[model samples]
Target: MTQLVGSLPPRWILRDPYAHQKGIPRFPRVVATVLAARGITTRPQAEAFYRPHLLPEYDPLLLPGMPEALRRVERAIEQRETIALFGDFDVDGVTSIAILHEGLAPLGAATIPYIPDRFSEGYGLNLGAIRTLADAGATLLITADCGISSVTEVAYANELGLDVIILDHHTVPEVLPPALAAINPKRIDSPYPFDELAACGVAYRFLQVLYEHLGRAFDDTAFIDLAALGTVVDVAPLIDENRRIVTRGLEAMRAGLRPGLQALARVSGVAPERFTAETLGFALGPRMNAAGRLAHANLALQLLLAPTAAAAATLAEQLNALNRERQRQTEEATALAEELLGPEDAPLLFVASEHISPGIVGLVASRLAERRNRPAVVLSRGPEESRASARSVPGFDIVVAIRKEKALLVRHGGHRSAAGFTVRNENLELLRDRLIATAAEQLGCQPAARVIEVDAQASLADLDGLEIKGLMAFEPTGHGNRKPVLLSRGVELREARPVGADRSHLRLTLRDGRVTWRGIAFRQAEADLDARVDIVYSLQRDLRGDGVELEVLDIAPAAAARPLEIRTG
Candidate 1:
């Protein structure tokens, strides 16, 4: 019988040394490996990456409909029109809402922000909501983070004598919406240089262009900070303009110019100076997303718009409480999912239940996919239709698999790793079987072993405080650019003991030759005990004011360390 957990070894792909090559600007070996792995080839490219800058000009305005969108918005601003900002119910949507609300305030427009209910309205635009916005004295409706696929809804808005402007970043549908202007970089006719901007990113750029169109001087310092939050929370690739946005945004955030972010950091126990991509990914983003997942995203948007520190702190506390509930819901849903699909080796894992929260099914799929090392779809079933969120492994595209079953789905769309769909209760079983066969065909007969790519090989002696600090230049890590993973060979463990409340984490003092370093491995209680072992880890500054420490990714006995097969997408 196979054990509940598989024991396949991880594949390590270390980058070859490139700093020694002629014409390449020389950096430390480990830093060079990180750059090389990220494909930073030229000297200018390295310099630009080392000191990334916010773009000085507009690139998003190049999208096909952006010019017209700006013109409509400028006319609305001149007329002091009542504009409604429709947003989704997530961190990205909330942040985008805040940015556009602030962006339009100085332009003499009365902006009303509307975040659809996750349970009631589902994902995108609904006709009833459109009527509600119009009744609220909104003559113009602009959608952020959603509305790219709202074809019939836009036509209805037009019929109601409301001009619609869409600021979205999702994959464009076969037929575009009938909005006055739909600005999506992914549109088939879009000429935007970059197509991966998060919804708030698109909103921020639109503000920049709108200012330009009105002949106004725009200082983008604060709007970019909001955009950075959405970009990081959306897990958009940290490249091109995203790199510029986050890199500079962190600096602006530390300045505490934005009252909401400052208060959020204070209540979240994060020092402004220490905020980074990792901080957003783990601490702040979850709290911002928690309200959207559990109760209402308005609470989060309120935090951003909080007028004073006291108000922001109060809202932050509320959001923090909501986040705790979201965590509990996620844990319950994941346990239920695991129980339903016990000890199975299916290519794709599918689970539908009333136990999962509609807002958290995507998170459940992510958690299951990471654990099972296979594509997972978790559905929160409703009476007439079931909403399913799917997450995929590194190689297989879950969105493509979902597309194959389009005939059975009401609607579905997402990127390669993640997607969602609404299917009737009756079609759920057929959807599962279709995906199983699709997974078998797209992925080979047998799934490849899970792989962990090492970024470089370094000795304990090589990882000084300065080396670790130098590597910190690789800030704002996510999606395309991740924190570097380095391997240290044959390190003897001087002391090892279980840590953390559940005793699932390992705290270690490791020695290699005469050099010693502290290390911690989260949830590594099952690690094999060995006198000497090769450990793959990432470097971080020691919180105790010590030099540096290692965050172990994986550990194996020196003798047992061997290569695993590489599977490419």
Candidate 2:
């Protein structure tokens, strides 16, 4: 996984074993070892981890302003007041808009969904946009995936005789907005249970509470599927209620139930029965996000709002084509950013160019940070202002770093791992310097190392039928609840060759005593497979409907300290 051509290999750290010292009825050994490595020691925790449940969702009324927001929405429904939903331009934002609009549609509410242009309006509330919405006869303005940090815009909305309800999940800014209801779980004073919910999760909770308040029963889980899409797409942790939401959502999605999903699956070449977290996060999410990143997000929103199968199929095709274009642009932008970086010793990297699009800065930064293993800030410079997207390593909090430089920024907000901001072109130097200094303080002058973690050291015998079924118990895997990565030593590489059109992947046959395992390592076409190796891998079903295959993450020659006799093709 360490791709730097001449760099020393990263130290692989296997997770330490759990005590199980209390003699707590030692679990089915192999499965217990995996579960214990992930911190699920108790039997009840194991049960909850294995079987995710959505029953008895936390009360949304516990949210600081949810009850008040519900009351206002109820009144709006009774009086038939015009309502507008202001949403962000990403998949989470799009799904939030769809969920809220669909949730309120049956109540005779006059709802209009509005997504701001990425180039023109950027993110969150703006006074001009508020004036436009109010002018368009919107008496009530509800924000989805945004508006928590728009203190000024909310104040203006209030002055224009428009009641605003802000439903967001981003880290709260110091100064709160004066909206009629700002219902973010991350509020400093909030008593609501969980704070890690994606924006769409919050929106779903609100709707669920509203349904109860209206004396309505909704066992229909189609909406949960929407929430699940937004949650996984936004990279929300799949733990606790988030796990339940995604698991149930995946169940609904794989059933080929929702029109939007069915059409999207058809265009994306996803067989519904085979849908999983991988399909959602890698395939569907990126296509939906492609429209938002390259053009207007309303195209993605329209796909969700599509009524007919043909219309949905057409929108999905459009998005698929746009995604191809996005990939090309992203490759160009990433190469540009890499070319602009300084020496390799720097703890942080900041790259700016007019060549990169404001919409794609986040994508570029994410790629740079993941590849080079550090915080990266990619800026797209405009004539007057520049938009910067920041992505950080696991330990550093990029959001906190961005917050420290707020005085030099026009606007900034995001979670720990990712963030975005706008800065005046002239203040770019000051912003850059401050951010560099902050990263140094947060991460130290020493560089962050690239490390691939292994969950446990295992032998081929450990992966029996019991372990396989136990592993399957932990379904709907993604962020937080990740699939385990195991390392096995001294595996004989019987045969290896490059696969794929670009010859970027290695298809290998590995042997363990009498048993044999088939595997593929991504981006390791030139790997040194001539020598016996230790492999880091995950167990997965073969793509060809065969039994289990090993998905190789990395391979290190058996003798680590000794020089490798690598073959040069």
Candidate 3:
């Protein structure tokens, strides 16, 4: 047994006896215990968390100007007006466009889909694109995943006699865009109870309201799959309504109704029979995202909407190629960004290069934030304007921080954790200074670095098949729900050796008395293990043909003594 580096806070384990006695199932004692630790003790609350309702119970009109938006959509439906969907190039944007298109297409309304080139057009509504759509006889313009911050572009569209309806979920700027109807939950005047919906979620709700207004009977399940794909890929919280959407979406995906999704699953080596959240987030999301990051996002969008098996297969192969190219580009850009840092003492990292794709700056920013444990902003210099992406630690809202420096940015918007902006080359320094100063004032100090949290304490003897089965119950872990990491103390490292081609993996053994378990730590061959140590790990069956072994997340030296103290709440 090994003691892990981190321990669960005592407050998380101690629970109220009264709540436990109120008939909570303890068979999944750890589940109940953890839930109680998180302050969820009642049956109803647990049910809500574990099994979320996919259908919206809140009034759709609660969304800011949603009623007005519905009116416009209903009019377009009745008149058979040519409506154009303007969307971003990412997964959320693509899925939003598809959902709206699917929702309106069957209503005998003419709908056109348009995606801006990330390199040429940048993000959000552009005057050139709007004019082009107008030229194509589109009278009504609906935007998804974007347009919340396109104040000027929306005004331009309105000036051109184009009726614009905005459906978006991003940080609301101080001044609202001048669209005919702006449907956003983040608007300060919004009556919507929850403000955490993703872009696709907002689009779904908008369609739901429009369908209701039109008295159209549409199958809500048809869009759940797309909703789930977008929610999971966008990294939205898998709680509340999002949980319901993803849960049902995963079920639908497993059933293999959509040829495109099935083709993706086949090519990506994800068995439909064994689909889970991990498959969505890890296996599929990246592949789809790769298209946007490296090449045309239309490839991924086409794959998702492909009607025929042969078409899906062809698109899947194309997407696979794009993903490979994305990997190569990401590696190169990440290396360059790291080298650019070169021991800077700045509280924030602002790195820019002309070679990096603007579509992937956000991804690079995320990696930098993880490696440096600071807010990271990455930019790609465009000919006319420079585009940037920002990612931040907890407690620091990058979008809000960027908004505070709006004078230095030409355009900017995003969520609390991540954001994107564009600025002129001359204003880069000013933007950086303003963002740093704002962060210092708002955060007070650098946010605490992310720390590993152990779900339960374990010993080497507990690393059994039954324990592994128990862990499986916590499926589909992500932003809100995470995989449990257990810490074991005083683990005897019987042997250790390098395994990978680059000698980055460590294959070792942990033994306590007669109980011994084989363990492998990826990219941890360099870690020091001269003495007995604690290991934070997840138990996994290796299934390497002959047999299976366990995997270790991290192995660090055990504390000098066990800090043992227990108290009941």
Count steric clashes of candidate 3. 12
Candidate 1 per-residue lDDT over residues 396-447, each given as its tens digit: 9888788878889987767778888889999999999999888877775464
C-alpha TM-scores of all predictions: 0.95, 0.95, 0.88
Candidate 1: the clashing residue pairs are none
Q: lDDT value for candidate 1?
A: 0.82
lDDT score of model 3?
0.77
Off by over 4 Å in 3: 1-27, 54-56, 442-449, 458-471, 492-501, 507-522, 530-532, 538-551, 559-569
Give all candidates' CA lDDT scores.
0.82, 0.83, 0.77
How do the candidates rank by lDDT, highest first? 2, 1, 3
Off by over 4 Å in 1: 1-6, 15-25, 54-58, 544-547, 564-569
RMSD of 2: 4.0
